[model samples]
Target chain A: MKTAIDIENVSFAYNEQPVIRNVSMTIESGDFLGLIGPNGSGKTTLLKIMLGLQLPDSGSVELFGTPANEFAEGTRLGYVSQHSTDADSMMRVTVREVVEMGRYPHAGLRRLTDKDHQIIDDALKTVEIEEYADRRISNLSGGQRQRAYIARALASEADLLALDEPTVGVDADVVDQFYELLTELNAEGITIVLIEHDIAKVSEYAETMACLDGELYEHSATSEFLKSGALERAFSSARAVSSRSVTRGD
Target chain B: MATETTRQRRELGAVALGIPLVLLAFIVFVVWVFPPLFELFWNGMEQLFNEHWLVSSSFLQHGFTAGVLIGFTAPVVGSYLVNRQMALIGEALAHTAFGGVAIGLFVGASIPVLNYPLLWALVVAAIAALGMQYIAVNTDGYADIPIAIMLTGGFAVGIAVISYGVVFSATVESYLFGDILFVPFENVQLMVGLTLLVGLVVGLTHKQLKFITFDREAARLARINVWLYDTLLIVLTALVVVAAMQILGAILVAGMLVIPVAAAMQVTNSFNRGMLISIVFGQIAVIGGILSSYYLGIATGPMIILVAIGIYLLAIVR
Candidate 1:
């Protein structure tokens, strides 16, 4: 019955051009929500508002019953940004060091304690990346790197995890495994919110769906929404390419 | 498994022995062999410590004063510069400060001594630095152009002022090359006071600066004042530039700010670790360069920078 995120009549614009208009939605705790829309349909922008990374011009957002701005430090929120890149070239830090950054809000200015190290190790283990703990992040494959990033989020002990197209550059096998991991985490009561374009595949993993179209189009149970042809319309405008056939008729 | 353990043990033993051997050799070289080989070295060093205390204290005062001020302030400003990928802005500001110093000299301000005239010159330099940032932000596809223009223009101004000087009593060479030996007591006191003020500001605003540096949009969304932190960073940079100019000279000041930080970033994964490494590496450069300069009779600032660059190169090679 606890609401994790609440947004009310939110609108956003960039350079005076509207991107999101009068949108409102509430996500409850333990919900696995998938946001689906075509490219540039304001899915990412809406997520940004939820993450408190961007402001809505005319509305308000609250996380865990507190105003977004008034949330206390060390509140369990995890974010994996689209623009997160490998650290600068001059750095030669290992995977362990990068994951340790997630502990920063909890342990300010002090060295990592034994408990922090245990959390980091456990997070790495949860991501199945304990083997790569000592390896440099740059040397890892794209899938491995993404897993490292997930470990960083896991290390934060976050109650809510927000990912922006986490499967963008990953291979099919890794993507499948990543979804499995997400489901496992969801089973453990961590709320998951993700913006994904692979609507057909993601519907199996996500329990709830929010279809965005410059506004909040629909928010309903994922299976029920898909059965009602919601996703078909969201991605219905794909252009088909025709191919000529030479057969026995000729 | 037993063989593997033994092999590891041997490697560890080698490291333990190798480190001590190197330290022993260095101690012997510093204490025993070098004194008689360079006879005048000990006498000059003795005189430097004895007669130069008044002057050394002044220089120490200057170095510590400037070091403490810049050490605390530049890093806060640097947090933004690193995030913005505008690290070169510090270099441009140093050059602009050079121009301010030239104009101050041409107007009959004392060159070697710290005075109100030099302070006003620093203010002009700070304004110029801010102006350059504005231009860079407003222009499209030419982020580095404004900085490049300021650098060249500032140097040209310095040249013109030096050529048209009325009567030159102090050699301009010392300022350009940096003569830490000439630092007076008053300058030292001023340096220390300024550094403390900068430190307090940085400490108080640490979280705000970090938020803006890592994610500006998020900082804005959280309703944390972005412009206030941005302006504070630039002003702090300008103050650090003026303070460091005495020890490293105008042309070389930016090197000290950037090189150690760059090196630290090479080996650390976290921002906090990078900062700690940078301070440690910077101190090493300062101490090593000073000792080498005193022994070899070379320029102190360049020596320090060379040591830092050497560390950077070693990190790269490894």
Candidate 2:
């Protein structure tokens, strides 16, 4: 299998404070990899670095054999960030309009063709949100909104989908359905890298799991990863450091 | 699939060739065609209204023409700016254009050919816009901090330049507070060129602009050249501001950019629809303001703004 993402010794800092420290990993094509870490453990930062949304302070990342920062075929990758749901924004855009953005990378200074519209419609149908195509994005429920985003990714014809905390405010039943959708997409040979807080839920769905706490603790098949005890170590150490910092601040 | 690829290639080739050709054609239209076309429009309006002085008088004709063009262009560009929470950037650019006008006047008194204050205003406002975009992207702190600085700093520079004995004529006050009757035929022509240019550019880039405005992060990830679009939108705003400065004045110019869009947002659930509605509301405000100014002896700029505000209140209640 081809490598979808390759990160080597990548270190990142915000205001000189390191967020991701020498993190190294490789995500294979069509792999469903679950990246789980505590809040502020740099999962989001690592995802961004891999996507070339942010440059690392040190080391490097590659997407499909090209250096990530130089990778310009953006239509091949779809990203759903933590703030993907613009619930608070007053931007009055329809769901169809939002989905139409998926075609923008392909359209590029030209009008959308009938073929593009067909692709958009197919994506909307794939996500089962065809009924809400004309509704304002803000008017949708959280799960419905997430489905719209996934449809956008589908419309882009993205081979790699990176989702960060995609189910933050979703209900439990809907979250299950959402994960099932991810599994279906992954089975369809689209590579997925998900950042979720729920360890068991991720482990059940992900073929591989990686534990992170400013650094990679372990990365392996889901069964081996669960048996590795890396999660306990990473979480416990993070607790110790955070408590220590709290005391020092006081 | 092969046919699709071929078709797309053809489209791409057309676009590659089309943009420069379209811009060149628009320039030709503006230069050789628009003045006569505008004269014909006014002549028709005059005859349609039985040669009423409001339509026939050259002063009202120029003012009304300029006002209507501003009505269409400002709100169209403003839709993106307002939705992006960069509304005040328009105000800041207007102030910078004011400074440019002062410098242009000061310099023109010395040199004979460089007397077009609006031209100077365009140059200064465009530069200031790029500078603000740079600062907003590179520097820390809220986006508005730089905007606020540009706002006051620009006005301060204008005041200083004007105080330096730069023949502060009623023309300066007209640019400051806006005087509809003060528009010249040449300036009206400038507004027509600007309106067409703005309309063309916005029409071409509406998808990119709307995408970025609705979601900046997703736009950047999609390799939409977020920074380039940001610069383009701000520069367009500067163009609109400078063009509007003649009739709306610097202080009131931002109102035209902001008010119509705000009202449209209150009524519509789709961004594209909101843009269209805002343009309609802008036309209403401009026409209503011109008529009110004629009958009630009020300032055209303020009356336009007030009419827009009235529409906004009505929209909110609805």
Candidate 3:
């Protein structure tokens, strides 16, 4: 199987403190990979490195067999940031315009072509937001906005889609729906890397899971890792805090 | 459903009629009332276009040439200025350019050889603009300190230059008040050429500019040469200010750069649409203001700027 992402000895630091230490991981094509960690545990930073939006101090990232730096412009890579709210506040751009930006890498310096419009339409339909295509993006609720972003990513025709905390701020039912949408996309052979905080949801949705805390801890099939108590070991402190709270309540 | 359809029809009807009514009013003012009003203003319009014409013997050509030149250029650079939140910097640069004009007057009187005083003034103003940008970027503590100092200090120098001698007081007043009647053919050509150049540069570099404005960190990560683009924008702004100051004067040029874009932003949903609307609004303000100023025998630049501000107010209220 072709490797979708390869990270070797990747490390990052702000000032003197290391955020991510010499971590190495590989994701195969068509894998629904979930990266989970505590807040400030370098999950987003690692994803940025893969997106070529940040430089790693000690190692390299290769996406689609090309070094991250050498990846061609307009290469099929889609990213949905945690701060998608920022895009929400500034403009009353329609859902279609936001998705149209996904085609920007390919449509550089040229007006959007018919094919681009068709792709955007297809993406909106695929994410089931076609009815809201002409609606102002700011008018959409949080769940609807999240789905709109998903459509934007889908419109890129990207072979690899990286989402940082896609389920944050979304209601539980919507979160499940979002996961179902991702599962359908994955089944269609698109590689997805989801950065998430909820261990239960990540385990439920991802085929492969990696628990990171300044370093990689467990990397294995989600079902086997859960059966082996690997997740509990990685999140023992969190579990302890939660159980203590439950006992106090009782 | 019937009510909704009726409401949509009414709204569409209003827009369709409103656009044509505005156009008609503009035409009536320009054609029917403007010529008689021009005759009443001590023949300033006649002088602007006739034998004493600053450029040539065509009043309509001269007014429109000046109007279109200011209309096209200001908003192109103004769009970026609004996006960067550097509208105040344009104001400071205008004040600094005024100092340059004062220096030009002083030098022109002292030396028997210097002929193109405005050129010297623009050069000094451009230098001051670039110097302020450098200080603002390099200084650590306060962002507005450098601008405040430059604006006040430059104006003080201008006052000193004026007090030192009285050789070109009338010309200085024209510079301060902005006499569109005095705009020569050569200056009109220059303004038109610079406007086109700046507009083309902006069109080519729109992506880089938008990227930097939208997300500086992302732009830096993309190896976009942020500092280079920032300085390029500053220099472009300086050039636009110098060109615009010739018609609008130093004191009022910044208003033209800012108010139209601000008004357009209130109504438009996207950056490109905002820019286009701003240019359209700017032209309306200039043309209307000039005709009114000619009729009332008042200074042209402030009148135009005030008209633009009025449009902004109306847009907000609406």
The number of the candidate with the highest lDDT is 2
Alpha-carbon runs more than 4 Å astray in model 3: A84-88, A227-250, B1-64, B92-177, B205-232
Q: How do these models rank on TM-score, best leading? A: 2, 3, 1
Residue-by-residue lDDT tens digits, candidate 3, B1-318: 001123333543664666567556545655556546534543565565574433334544455566667877787778777666677777777777778778888887778577455666668777886787788777775767887887788788888888987756778776676777777655655565566557755765675566556545444433445676687787777777777777788788888888988888778666667778999989988987877777787877888998899999999999
Query: How much lDDT does each candidate structure score?
Result: 0.68, 0.88, 0.73
Residue B72 in model 2: shift from native, Å? 0.9
Going through the candidates in order, their DockQ values are 0.19, 0.43, 0.13
Sort every candidate by lDDT, greatest first.
2, 3, 1
Worst 10 residues of 1 chain A by lDDT: A241-250
Candidate 2 runs further than 4 Å off: A84-88, A246-250, B1-23
**What value does the lDDT take at residue B148 in candidate 1?**
89
Residue B56 accuracy (lDDT) in model 3: 37
Query: Which 10 consecutive residues of model 2 chain B have the lowest summed lDDT?
Result: B1-10
For candidate 1, please provide the TM-score of chain A on its own.
0.90
- Identify the CAPRI category of the predicted complex in candidate 1: incorrect
Q: Give lDDT for model 1.
A: 0.68
Provide the clash count, candidate 3.
0
- What DockQ does predicted model 2 obtain? 0.43
Task: Give the per-residue Cα lDDT of candidate 2 at A10.
Answer: 96
Cα misplacement distance, residue B70 of candidate 2 (Å):
0.6
Answer with 1 or 3, whichever has the higher DockQ. 1
Please give, for residues A1-250, the per-residue lDDT of candidate 3 as tens digits: 8998899999988665677889999999999999887656678888888877777998999878877766553326777777754435654356776676666545543456899989988999999999987777777877788788777667767778888887778888788888999999999999999998888888898999888766787778998777776556656744554544221100
